[model samples]
Target: MAASGRRTGRPTLEEVAARAGVGRGTVSRVINGSPRVSEQARTAVQRAVAELGYVPNRAARALAGSRTDAVALVIPETEARLFTEPYFLDIVRGVSGELAEADKQLLLTLIRDDKERQRFEQYLAAQRVDGVLLVSVHRDDPLPDRVRMLGLPAVLNGRRSEAEPVAFVDSDNVGAGRSAVAHLAGRGRRRIATVTGP
Candidate 1:
């Protein structure tokens, strides 16, 4: 519908599916990042999205319980040193690889304060992400606990606890940390400072 209350023939979900030569459900599955979709179907749907300039209606989708089709790898770290950490880069690479296979995009958020976390809650409450992957949280951090209370599926990058509900992927941090110091010792460095945190 146009501002003049006339139909402008704007594309609809059905049209998009038809243009992609796939069923409506298939189109939706692709749009929602369902792993069952084939790459060929995914490509066709993406082509239709580009050709028709289709923009999903968030309000309507909310009623249907459709996800916003997004995810975030939020880090509670300072922006200055965000990119300087090699571990973050490796983890990002691993995450990017998995997310790319699903054709899902990752949004990054820096939650470093009460004010920022407040704003983060507002944005997250919009249901923009299907889930969240948080990194660099402290032992006593309240963010992960808060995220769980919101009924959102969240995973921590580092292992916090076995009893903790947050799902995570972590390396042998303790063992790796020890190996790093030993390697430095063999390199003839007598003094070192572990500055992994702010």
Candidate 2:
């Protein structure tokens, strides 16, 4: 088929191959900038690509170069917790937006209990994702330590404690709470109680 005929969506490699009068491997080599392909084949493939207005899939290209271009967003919460709390949803939204800009995919995994946690650890060991983002990990959770030992690029939403080894992002809960209490006191609400969360 002609290059213009397949312009409705992203043009595939086969269309480029047919247009270039070469095989799929030759087109792949040309796209990957391999020197093994002949100059004639490369030029033909390039012209075909230009004519087709072909844009290479970043994820496929990354995989061709031995990279996944995927990040795992690990949430250590039960199904009930995930639905009841808006925090996880907020994190997923922000992460998804940012990752889309970067042309990466997010693999969300919720490790509710020890069994799931162990299974996830095994999956990580297989190098499924390029990096990890851990959310709501408590001190007792072994995920942080296990992820660290795997030498994966991992970031936590909050630190397990004051001396967390891995990278983490923490909100100023203390400052926010203090400001709230002061505001309440100013309104003559003396019987205020501060409730902490897990």
Candidate 3:
């Protein structure tokens, strides 16, 4: 208890229920956005929450619901490469934005070696996150297949090959190059020289 006669720590669900003049379950239903809650109860609970400045304990909620509401974005690259490459930075930014909109947490993971990859697989087996998003996959990388075997939801930022079996989002480099060349040729340019990296 505090000097003011209130609890010193964060407000509890029971306290909110008492303040709202409803049962504990009603408060929970209102907080969880359940349709079963009546408008009057919902309004009362919302008012109580606002007045108490209540914030839900995510870990407790996850334990109760069996959902972490989190997504792990696995990038198999060195910290130097991850920070230095604009392509990687762009992917992080885009994923962060989308995850924010969905009200889900993003766990950005950098796996640089086999040990770290093994650790991540262990974490996956623990069911720590709801889903995964993989980026910067190599042609022969087995992590994608491992994730599939675990029956976890995953999306790859880019495909390892044209016949990639996993769900992936990739740009059509060949089609893009063809379109660029056609556009350039239509403008009366014949000497087409391009630069690419290995």
Candidate 4:
């Protein structure tokens, strides 16, 4: 405890409770915006919080509620590729915009090798994120299954196969190709050759 009779570190929930002349649970309820708290108690907690300059500890609150309020967007690619490739950049922009609207933090991770993949698995095991968004997955990548096994919600940008068990979002390559060809044919281009990916 400090000489002021409060804890030595940052002002804790108990200190706020003491200042507000309310129980610890009442302080918590008021801080969490619980509707059950009476107007008078809420006003007291707010006043105490402002007077003491108390800021809620996010890490402690996450541990208590089992919610980090953060989402990890894992892209297994090199930094060069992530920056150079317009597709990856577009994905990042779209995901960031949506996550911002939803009030969630986005953790962008790039796994370039087996070693990094293993390290990411360990990080997931620690339950540090609320959910995961996996992009640019390979056919044999094991991360999708590993994320599922950890019991965390996950969504893949694309699927490995038609029978992919994980939830995914993918573009219509065939439809896009057909549309492109039709556009060229409409412009009276006879010889239409398409280049496909490896």
Please name the candidate that would achieve the greatest TM-score relative to the true structure: 3
lDDT string, candidate 1, 1-198, tens digits: 679965476678898898899999988888767999989999999999889888777556656876655788888888766789887778678888889898677787887888998888778777777888998887877778778887789998875676667777778878999999999999999997897855
Model 3 TM-score, all chains together:
0.91
Residue 177 Cα positional deviation in candidate 2, in Å, after optimal superposition: 3.2
lDDT (Cα, tens digit) per residue for candidate 4, span 50-163: 998899987888888898978999999999999999999999999999999987788999999999999999999999899999999999999999999999999999899999
lDDT of each: 0.82, 0.89, 0.93, 0.92
Q: What is the TM-score of each candidate against the true structure?
A: 0.60, 0.69, 0.91, 0.77
Model 2, span 1-198: residue lDDT tens: 457754566889998999999999999989877899999999999999999888888778877786778999998888888878787788889999999998789898988878999999999998788899999888888888898899899899989899899999889999999999999999999999977765
What local lDDT score does residue 126 receive in model 2, on the 0 to 100 scale? 83
Alpha-carbon error at 85 in model 2, in Å? Answer: 1.5
Question: Which stretches in model 4 have alpha-carbon errors above 4 Å?
Answer: 1-9, 97-103, 172-195
**Against the hidden true structure, what lDDT does model 3 obtain?**
0.93
Q: How accurate is candidate 2 locally (lDDT)?
A: 0.89
Off by over 4 Å in 2: 1-50, 57-60, 181-193
Alpha-carbon deviation at 132 in model 1, angstroms: 0.6
Q: Where's the lowest-lDDT run of ten residues in candidate 2?
A: 1-10
Better of 2 and 3 by lDDT: 3
Can you give the lDDT of residue 64 in candidate 1?
Answer: 81
